[model samples]
Target: RKGGAEMTQREFKDMPSRIARLPRDKRGFPIPKFVGAVDKKGEPDFRLVSHDHMAACVRRNLCWICGDVMGTRKAFALGPMCCINRVSSEPPSHYECAVFAAKACPFLSNPNAKRRQRDLPEAGEVAGIMIERNPGVTAIWVTRFYSLMQVSNGVLFFVGEPEGLEFYARGRAATRAEIKASIASGIPHLEEVAKRDGRGAMSELKRMRKRFDALLADRVPA
Candidate 1:
C-alpha cells in the first residue's frame, strides 16, 4: 500500500496471518521455497520476494524456536510444536536466575529422566509435567546453534556457536553457558520486563531446567 512497497494488499494481509498461526519454517501456504536467499547489504538471507516487494510487505516477527528472523514467508505449520522440539526444549523462554514451581515434579517419576539422574533423577518427568500444566510454553529452536550437555555439578547448560546459556528461568533444555554470557551481556535490558520473583518462579525454574536437560538427553557439559 505504501509507496516503494511491492506487496499488494493480498500479500500484505497474508504475512501476519501466516506468522501468527504457523510455528515451523518448513510448512505454510503460499509455500515459499528458496526462490533464492539474498544477502543484501543489510538484509538477512532467505529472501522470498524482491527487495521492493518485501519493503512494501510488512515484516513479521520470527518464531522463538528457529531464530529465523524472516516473516511468515518461510514459516512452518505446526505452531510452536515442531519448532520447540527441534531445540533442547519445548516452549520458548529466556531467563536465568529465577525460581521454578510446577505440578507433579515429573523429575521424581520419569524413567527417561534417569540419564540425567547424576544431577536430577527426574528431569524428564519434570519436563513432561510442566508441558502438561503449561501447554502454552514457548520452546526455542537452538539445536542449530548450540551444543547441549550436562555438567559435573549436575547443572545443565548449552554451548551455543557464539555463547553458552543457562536457563535460570522456566522451560526445558540444558542451560547453556553461552546463554549465561548472553544474560550477562545485558540481554535483560533488551527484555520487556525486569526479572522479579513471584509465587511460582522457583519451582518453575527447577522444573523447566530439568525438562530442558531431559530433552537434550545430556547434562550441561562441565
Candidate 2:
C-alpha cells in the first residue's frame, strides 16, 4: 500500500456502497472486485472497486493491479507458485505487476516457485470463479499474487495465483539456502495466526504451506 496514490471524494463514498450491493455466489463469495480505489491508508479494503468502475474495467480489459486499460494484450495472471489442485479465476494484470509482485509479494519471492500453465474451466464448474475468453498470453510470476475474499461466514479467504509466468531482473537471486531460511522464519507468524483464528484458519494456512512444500520438493538440487 506504500506506493498507492490519493483517492477522490466521489470514489471514497461510492465504492463501499457498491461492494455491499454486489451479488454473492452460492458459497457466499462476492464477485471479485476490480480494485481501483483504496482507503486513506492506501489499502484495498473491502469497500474498494465500485460496480460501475469494475464493469468499465472489464469492458476495457484493464490491468487488475494498476487499474489502467492495458496498452498491450501481453499481460500476466498472478497466482500460486505451487499448483496443488488450485485454480485462478482472477483477471489479467500488467506485465509490470508480475515483476512487482514477484519482488514485493512474500510467497512469490520464494526461490522454489516456477511458472506453470493453469486451466481455467468454464464458469459453472466453480461457484464464483469466472474466466476471460481469449485471455492474454498466459503469463505468471514465478512467485505469485494474493487476493482477499470475504466469504459467507465473514471469514477472509486468502487466494493465490502463480500462473502466466514472467520475471524481471531487479538484482541477483538469493541462494537456495537463503530462500529456505527466509521461509523457515516466516512459519512462526503463520502459526500465530492459526492459533489466534481457529481450525478453519489453520487449515487454510496449512494448505498454503503444502503448496510451498510442493514447490520446495520439486526444486532440483543445485
Candidate 3:
C-alpha cells in the first residue's frame, strides 16, 4: 500500500516526486487509476475511466490517481459544478495527486480545452447529465468523510462537506474572478435541475451554494 503522507496545502508547479512515481503513458502523463484499457494489449485511454476501477476504489478506500491505499483524509478533484452538486462520478484521490491533476490536466485547467465527446463509451458516463463543459476551475475537495451512492446503472461519490478546498486554474491558484465566473455560468443549469427535482433538492442546492459563498470569499486574487 502506498502511504501517501499529508503534504503542505498548495498547488504544484513542476511535477512532484510522488506524482513521478505513478506509471506514465507513452505521452508521459501519469496514468490515473480510473483509465481503462482500450484493447487486449491493455493500452490505456486517459479520457476513458474504468467502471471496474471506480467500484474498486470505493470498496477499498483507494486513491483515484495513484491506485494506492489512502490515508484517512480522501480528496476529490472535481469541477466547480461538482462542488455545487456535492456529487462526483470519480472517487477520492490523494491531495497532491488531485492538485497536480487540477493544475496539469488540460481539460480542467484550460477553459478552452474541449472534452472529446466522439466515440465515448457508455461506461464513461455515470448516473447524471454530466455537465459536459469544463468549468475552467478545479476544486480539490479534501475531507475525512464521503458516501458511496448507487445511482441508475452506476455509482456516484456523495462528497461530504469539505474539511477544506483549493481551487486551481491554468496551472496556478485560481483567482476569485475566475471562480466567480465559472460558478455564475454553472448555477443556472444546477438551478434548473434542482427545480426539476423539487423542494428537497432545491434546499440542498441552497446549502451547497451557501458553502460556496464562504469558500469563494476566501479566494486568491488575480
Candidate that would win on TM-score:
3
* TM-scores, all models, native as reference: 0.20, 0.38, 0.85
State the lDDT at 119 in candidate 2. Answer: 34
The pairs that clash in candidate 3 are: none
Tell me the spans in candidate 3 whose CA falls farther than 4 Å from its real position: 1-13, 39-43, 218-222
Worst 10 residues of 3 by lDDT: 5-14
lDDT of 3 by residue, 1-222 (tens): 237864333333677567777677655577777777664456676767777777788889888887888898989998888887788888899888888888888687799999886666776665667776779888899999988777776778888867778888998888888888999988888988889999999998999899778776764444
lDDT (CA) per prediction: 0.28, 0.42, 0.80
Instruction: After superposing candidate 1 on the true structure, give the runs of residues whose Cα lies further than 4 Å from its correct spot.
Output: 1-180, 183-197, 213-221
lDDT: which is higher, 1 or 3?
3
Clashes of each: 47, 14, 0
lDDT, residue 39, candidate 3: 40
Q: How far is candidate 2 from the true structure (C-alpha RMSD, Å)?
A: 15.0
- How does residue 167 of candidate 3 score in lDDT? 88
Error of 3 at 60 (Å): 2.1
The lDDT leader among the candidates is 3
Ranking by TM-score: 3, 2, 1
